[model samples]
Target: MNLNLRHAIMQNISGNSQEELRETIVDAIQNGEEKMLPGLGVLFEVIWQNCSEQDRQEMVQVLESSVRK
Candidate 1:
């Protein structure tokens, strides 16, 4: 939950294969751990920085879906 751990996890994410990261994220969510949200926010920021307009819209959709749950 601390910023250090969050940064560490974000760094670790780059090392994970896509499937591994996907599983880790899914598990984190299923357990209802709010700390993961911050790290996910970081990931979203990283993606948004370079994402195209269409991708940004998709990201907003994803955010909306999460908020509705």
Candidate 2:
């Protein structure tokens, strides 16, 4: 898992249709991928750094709910 490649991918497609991205990610997860999730932490970090206060709170809540599961 290359962090630089991950960052590049995120930046390049940051504005693309999210549904397509979600489907691709879900497919990866269905294939029993490990990097699919751990990479989320990096994405979340990027979002956190740029998100507003309300968005940050929402992100934390969403992440917490997943953690509880």
lDDT of each: 0.80, 0.72
Clashes of 2: 0
TM-score of each: 0.66, 0.51
List runs of model 1 lying over 4 Å from the truth: 1-6, 65-69
lDDT score for candidate 2 against the true structure: 0.72
Give the per-residue lDDT of model 2 (tens digit) for 13-48: 578687876765667678777766755555556678
Clash-forming residue pairs, model 2 = none
